[model samples]
Target: MEAIAYERATNIADAVKAAREPGTAFIGGGTNLLDLMKGGIAHPLKLVDITHLRDDGLDAVRALPDGGIRIGALMRNSDAANHTLVRERYPLLTQALLAGASAQLRNMATIGGNLMQRTRCPYFYDTAFAACNKRAPGSGCAARDGYQRLHAILGASEHCIAVNPSDMSVALAALDANVQVVGPDGARQIPIGEFHRLPGDRPDVDTTLRPGELITGVDLPPSRLADRAYYLKIRDRASYAFALVSVAAALQVQGDKVAAARIALGGVAHKPWRASIAENVLIGRTLDDETLREAAAAQMRDARPQHGNRFKVALAERGIVRAVNVAAGREPAGVTGAPA
Candidate 1:
């Protein structure tokens, strides 16, 4: 990366002002920004270090008046995953974090940075490539008919098909985590499910974060059901690698009948893929093989896959079935290679 002007904002006000300038981006952990800059994917004229301004109780998880837990944006992934509240209440989130990159990466990577990482699509990251809708809107999506093992099967558009790459986010989605943003307009809260957007017609823009808006905190809701929740990720390696198909599930089973189920899948969609169809299918049913298979099938009723990654369809079904078994009070059977 060429030498770029750098500045540090010690407070949110200063950070907001610096971030509003054109070609100026905020740097929290610098894990994502630095990599993007070095690869020429991001050419911010000014790099404003907001890492210090983010020192507002990022390590603590507090209960809110509205029955939610506030998680500071600067909190490290490792801290959040191992936190007492996280371990007891959001087990899936903890499992997801543990299955991610590594303990060292978890220490350096902030919760906010993981939520904002750029697409892992190789074409978009390499500046040498000419056409990538996310890198340059309206240019084109090379992955449209190219290598898409990790692309979306849902909410895809003509512009892009890359999946959002965050294991924590998928678990958070399953737990109904909310986001807290500070901006020139004022402070606001956005539900985690709504924080990121579908590809729609413009996949270049991944979120609804307004200009000068900064994600300062995240609110995780308390869920009694999540005490038994779990996350299962299937990847290419046992080490630091992204998921090929992952499931984050929280189910409340009462005497072989599912009282409630919150299901979300990763590595298969633009946003965290919530199994809305499957959730409806399992809400009041027993976890027999037939029921599990039906729910799994329902989730991918409209799934469309490419040449190299068509196996994801079958893999995703098995993942859904296994995740359902866990939700049904059975120990995950012979789960190998990775979680699920």
Candidate 2:
């Protein structure tokens, strides 16, 4: 790891000031940052330790003018998951958090850090590898053709195909979460759907965050859509492994027909892949296996699989069916994937 200067910030302003320097980054939990540094993936010139900034630290989730939950960026994953408000109001969010890494990791990881965690592409992790566009700009993506079982199926371009690895993000996107960013220009809120981005032509840039801009909070809109929702994660292992294909679905069931639904897919996209088509299909339909199969297939209509990840397309469909069924209070029949 490169030698880097470290500074403890007493407040948000100091943290912002320290992060304004070139090649400097704000440290929240340091879990991802330190790991990337040791792996030679990120060698920052300066690290502004913001965990000590108590007041500015992400905390508090309050009702906002837009009938949304304003979540402080510094809130830990564990706390957010177990929070009475979150669990009661958004069970899908809680389920997504429990489906992620170990409890200890969740305790240490912050909401902002979770959203900012980078891709789990093997090429990106191996420093000796020369073809990781995200780790090194214009270096090319080796995963495009080499051992890519966990690569993306949607929103991928020629430049990159690494999937964003956050189960909670899928639920948040399905719930219509909003991101609040604080920078030198003050503050602004970005809807969670637009907060994460596809590689497009710039694989090097994974998110919409600008240099020196800090994530202040995440705002989740009030939803009748979320009252009935489910989150399901399927991985190679029963525990501690990254997702193979995950689903976060929220449904508004009126009698036998669906009034509304929100669906997002994980592990098969550059970011959380919301199944808008699937949601549209459910708005006026019934929650049955046939309807689920149709919506699930529609969700993957344009999914272009890569060298070793064709199974992900099938797994993604099954995942959506199971998750949606679970959300609709069904028995999750014929769900051929690992339980979350």
Candidate 3:
């Protein structure tokens, strides 16, 4: 790790000011940032600890008057998952959060940090590889011609194929969440769908957040899918393994017909891959196995997987079908190495 200076801001303004300095980064749970620093992937000269920003009440989860939920940035993953409002109103978010890392890590990971978590690409972590575009821009993407079983299948540029590793962000995308950010210039709202950017030409910029901007909280809009939601994760292990294919499915069913639907895929792109095309295929249709298959197929129609990860195309298809079925009350939810 490089030599660093640490400063804990007692307020949001101070935090923003500290972060404005060149080569400065904000510290949240330090779950992801610390790992990158240890790997020499991140070399910040100063750390502005904003884990206790007072302006936004950064650790509360409260119900909004409009039936939405507001989650503060510093709220721990475990607490947010178990919060009464979250469990009762955003079960898909709860399920996705629980499906991630172990209990100990969840207890330390914050909502902001989780959304800002880095990719788990092996090449991005090993300094021995000098071709990771995310690590060293313009060098090249090692995963393009290397081990790609866990790389992206959609929204990938020729320069990078790394996938976003946050299951919670996937659920947020499906829930139509909005991120509140405060920076040197003041505040702004970024729709969750537009928050994480595709790895177009600039793979180094994972999110749309500007320098010195701090994510204050997330707002989840009103939805009726709370009672009809499912999170399915498929990985190499039964637990504690990163997802190879994961789906966050939620539906609003009117009698036997689908009134509204949201499907988002993790581990398949640079950001939470929203299956909007599949969603369009299911809305107003009769909920059934055939409809589920068609919707899943629609989502996979544009997938472009590389050599070792082509199997993900099929795995994602099956997982999407299963997730939507489970969300529609036609299937049971399960966890493990296989799509549930």
TM-score of each: 0.94, 0.95, 0.97
True-vs-predicted CA distance for residue 145, candidate 3, Å:
1.1
| Model 1: pairs clashing at backbone N, Cα or C within 3 Å | none
Put down candidate 3 lDDT per residue, 1-340, tens digits, no spaces: 3589999998988998888889999998999999999889999999998876777558989888899989999999999999999999999999999989888989999999999999999999999999999999999999988999999999999999999999899999999999999998899999999999998888999999999999999999988899999998898776677899999999998988889999999999999999999999999999878878888888899999999999999999999998888887787765523433
Sort every candidate by TM-score, greatest first: 3, 2, 1
Identify the superior model by TM-score, candidate 2 or candidate 3: 3
Q: Which runs in model 1 stand beyond 4 Å of their true positions?
A: 1-3, 333-340
User: In candidate 1, where is summed lDDT lowest over 10 consecutive residues?
Assistant: 331-340
Over the stretch 76-183, how does candidate 2's per-residue lDDT look in tens digits?
Answer: 999998888788878889888888888889989999999999999999999888988888888898887798898999989998989999988998989888888878
TM-score of 2: 0.95
By TM-score, the best candidate is 3
Ten residues in a row with the worst lDDT in model 2?
331-340
Report the lDDT tens digits of candidate 1 across residue range 1-340.
4667788998888888888877777787777778888887888888888777845665467677776678788888899888887787777888888877877888888888888887788889977778898898878888877888887777777788888888888888888888888898988998888888888778778888888888888888767786557678898887688888989888988876888999999898878988889999988887788988999998888888766578888889999888767755676535433643
Q: What is the TM-score of candidate 1? A: 0.94
Which residue pairs in model 2 clash with each other? 58-74
